[model samples]
Target: MRNERKFYIDGQWVDPLKPNDLEVINPATEKPIGVIAMGTAADIDRAVAAAKRAFATYSQTSVEERLALLEKLLEIYKRRYEEMARTITAELGAPITMSTEQQADVGVGHLQGFIDALKRLKTREVLPNGDVVRREPIGVCGLITPWNWPINQIVLKVVPALATGSTCVLKPSEFTPLNAILYAEMVHEAGFPAGTFNLVNGDGLECGAALSRHRYVDMMSFTGSTRAGIAVSKDAAETVKRVTLELGGKSPNVVFADSDLEEGVADGVAQCFNNSGQSCDAPTRMLVERSAYDKALEIAERAGRQAEVGNPEEEGTHIGPLVSHIQFGRVQALIEAGVAEGARLLVGGPGKPEGFETGYFAKPTIFADVNNDMRIAREEVFGPVLSIIPFDTEEQAIAIANDTAYGLAAYVQTGDPDRADRVASRLRAGMVHINGAPHRYGSPFGGYKQSGNGREGGIFGLEDFLEIKTVHHPARM
Candidate 1:
């Protein structure tokens, strides 16, 4: 087993204040692949203090200098991209194909997005009233990322902080720390100043809370469950720090009758089941036009059956296991709930896939004739599960799509360009996907309402890490 039981702090890999070790298990094999040292409040303090001290100098660095460092980091990332993909597969049970294509790719994509955004950013500008407006780093950021899309969330938060000339202390999910460790190595090699970036491995209760509540921390950027996001907000409130979250979502996919029903439904199922259906913005709820509801159900059922569950070690289009046994259990329980709640289980039900008795794999599930109130429709199972709901009118479809507390992302599938534009404007979501369009790099990735505050990616991401200031001079001068 690999021994990775050290925390990266102040540009050095150091031992934890106390020896609290945690074993990282591979969900594909249900075995320990490595061990990482779990950090405590004291460790958070050390990391946060280092970040605070570094911010004094790092925040004042020129944008060109920061951009150069980021370019170096990006170069290193590209050179070792394959290692990152393999690391994610080993730790997170993501299929090697998806890990390489989507998971690890985000590190490069988002980093380049930030680089471009920084280049386009105007740090100093003059207002109409003869006041000079300047954008400055917010200082000493406390970044918390989840396990599902490890590198994706990390880059969304970390790159913007560094690009904006802010120092940060990261607390990546303990379940997937290997990739983070690799990233720390790249950051160090890129010649970032000591104390500019630090990482601690631990659960949310200790290291997370400590980072959020620390008096020296100026901002908190978190990506996780909605419940945990609330906790982070509460903790940060004590110190009045800036808190930005990219939390949970039960995003809706509206398929109109005019759409190519077969293709649309099939693509919807694939999106819902992508990453083993662990993505926060997965369109778990499919609101179909009543005229084509039955046909959509058939397409979804067929697509669900076709989704392959395979080994993360192998290179194939199949999805791997859930990140852990706990997640597996949660997914199983939700599957059971869908059945109990009276929704028709159109394709898969509860249990591990055949020939995969030892791993944390879940059957790709689809529930048709689902109402908005069903537990399967309301909750985020975070698995390969799809819930199909029927609606009669365009008004009704928009209503159902916006019913959820989460407004992260919504999808519109239609043949009519006018209807697509009309419905996209009405949907209560930060991002709208039209006719199976994918979210591209540099686009703002976030949501409204409970999906969390602030936007990430490109200029919007950089804006979140910046504080605005206006300098006034005498009009006579």
Candidate 2:
């Protein structure tokens, strides 16, 4: 079996402080494909020390110097672009095309965005009366990323940290370690200063806790569930380190009666099923006008049925198995919960997609006549499950969409520009997609409420890792 028993720390792959073996399962095959060594708190100490050491010199790096390294990374990433795509598909069960085109491509996109920002942004700003203001790297960072959209999450945090001259101790989700390991090799290959970037693999509590509580780690940037984000904040409070989080989203897609029914429903279904509805910003809750609710259900059912779920490596596979049995069961339990709460399951339910059923594949599910109060509508299923909630008016639709504790994303669909504009402006979300527009590559992305804090992407992403210092120059009286 392929084994990754060593952690990348201090610019080299080294054996773990203690051996704790964990088998990495191939979700599509339901078998052990590889093994990784789970790390202990001691491993985190060494990684943190290395990062702290690197930050002393790295933080003083010229913007031009950092840009040069990133430029090299962009080149190396392109050379191994296909390899990264295949690695994601093998470990995460993303369809090969999705992995290649979007999943892996997102990393390349973020790196390029950071590169452009680095060249354009001014690190130091001169003020009137000889005063000056500057943005500097916070310090060593603890980057904890999720399994869903692994590389995308990694690049958003790591690239910005490096760009701003902050070092990092990354603890990627245990579910997807190989890709992170490969990415570490890329960082190493790009010749980043030893300890500027490091990777430690382990379960959330062990390594995650260690990194979260580390005194040397000056900031914590996390992307995960809302519950976990709260925990990270509390842990970081001890050191009062900076924390930037992009957490859970039960985002709403509002479809007015004026829009093309077929097009809007199909787009919403495609998004909910994209990455098997594993995205934090997936528009799983579709709020439709009551007048067109029935037609929307029929359209949603048709769209869900059209999704071809199968082997991830095969062509035309729109959906694949959930990341692991634990995730599969979580999605299944939520689907069953929807049924129990009186929401009509128009398409799929708690079982695997009809085929040879050894893997963790989940049926693309759509629920109709859902109420905003229903458990299924409130909780994040994190699977290919869509809940359609009907509303009477635009105000009510906006209200229903904002009713959730999350405010990560909201969508608006309308043929009329005025209504789309009005409704979208009222939606309480960090990001809004009007007319089913896709997420822009370098735009600021994050949430408003319980969804978590701080923006990631472009200059906003880099700003999160930086601390502002205004050189007084004696505030002119």
Candidate 3:
């Protein structure tokens, strides 16, 4: 059965004020998969009004009640997990297996983490000076999510807003709106209040700008490129709304001579190419000690070669095409620029991988003898293109790593745990992965400098949606 195209506003699937429709394309097939209603300023107004109205009561709800609501949402999300995976596969061209495991599963993990965090949170506390400090909902929040890891980004913002008793108007990426629409359906099934949560699907100029400029919105949490994050900050400034941005990154993976060469190189390559290299925090820059540079390059090239590129629906296809034709063009341009600048292309260059000519796919690329000044090493290409830069000394490597404008994420691999920790401490990044450690759900995740401000995940995420109020009492005589 074909689904009706509508926005979720005021607890109902409502038509937009304007009928701007966008065609969702499967990057794997280069075909139109579905059509979605694109929102405008009017649509944002409607969603914001609904959220503002719902905040009056929802903000006052007890922690236990809110927890129960989140639990209900979790249950509904589980029932539709497969559907969510399929929707992402169709819309974003993420391999179905990868979507199910990494893409959709992370959303579930985030919601569950929120549920657990809320249970232990202390909303009200007594201070030393006979004062009461209360952490209250920050009112109607504006949530702007990115296309990469669509569901995970949405749930990270939404789950915490709900956990903190904040109402929200969400502007999900128009490119990948199917998973969001399905998510809205799941939220509706969870039976949230009429004005508690509203989903508005649209582009950055229309819906996103409206959310940022809306007076009723007390906070805006945005995740996307650093350029767009700057614009969102400027828009939110007019109303002095609290803004939390998780922006772009060109993260570095540093390998020491003492590290496990095979494991370090393999993990770094996998992390870079995961999600077909769409992640903002992918270890796109690899800095290895001069002594182990050749070994690391060999291992990384093998890992890149092993990546299977094909239709996202097919099993064992490790890498998929870029999200859209524009992205494909951008990646190809970057690859060409790298070659023109005289960097050695070790394996895989411009154009689609062998036997896959229909979609927007690129060969798994690796560039060696890359200087830190090269565009490929400096900018965020956001494809399966890996850069290998060798360092003669540890100090030089750390210096090279911190040379970029982005400070989102960094990875350090070394047999000596103390040395690894010391090196990680000096890197100018928000999150550091030591010895290929897995991401912890409840830990704070964010960036520094141009990368972004504030944190997401764990109590830090909930706090972003809250405002603290302190009441002082007279001391006993």
Best by TM-score: 1
Clash pairs detected, candidate 3: none
* Model 3 error, position 396 (Å): 1.0
lDDT of 2 by residue, 162-210 (tens): 9999999999988888889888989999989999999999977888888
Question: What TM-score does candidate 1 get on C-alpha atoms?
Answer: 0.99
lDDT pick, better of 1 and 3: 1
Q: Determine which window of 10 residues in candidate 3 has minimal summed lDDT.
A: 1-10
Model 3 agreement with the true structure over 347-448: per-residue lDDT tens digits: 799998889889989888899999999999999999988999999998999999999999999999899988988899899999999989978888888999
Clashing pairs in 1: none
Q: Tens-digit lDDT track for model 1 on 1-477?
A: 889999889999999989988999999999999999999999999998899889999988999999999999999999999999999999999999999999999999999999999999999999999999999999999999999999999999989999999999999999999999999999999999999999999999999999999999999999999999999999999999999999999999999999999899999999999999999999999999988988888888888888899998898888889999999999999999999989999988999889999989999999988999988888889999999999999999999999988999999999999999999999999999999999999999999988999999999999999999999989988
Alpha-carbon RMSD, candidate 2:
1.3
Q: Point out the worst 10-residue segment of candidate 1 by lDDT.
A: 293-302
Q: Provide the overall lDDT of each model, using Cα atoms, as 2-decimal numbers.
A: 0.94, 0.91, 0.89
Higher-scoring candidate on lDDT, 2 or 3: 2
Note each model's CA RMSD in angstroms.
0.7, 1.3, 1.2
Residue 390 lDDT in model 2? 89
Candidate 2 residues lying further than 4 Å off, grouped into runs, are 474-477
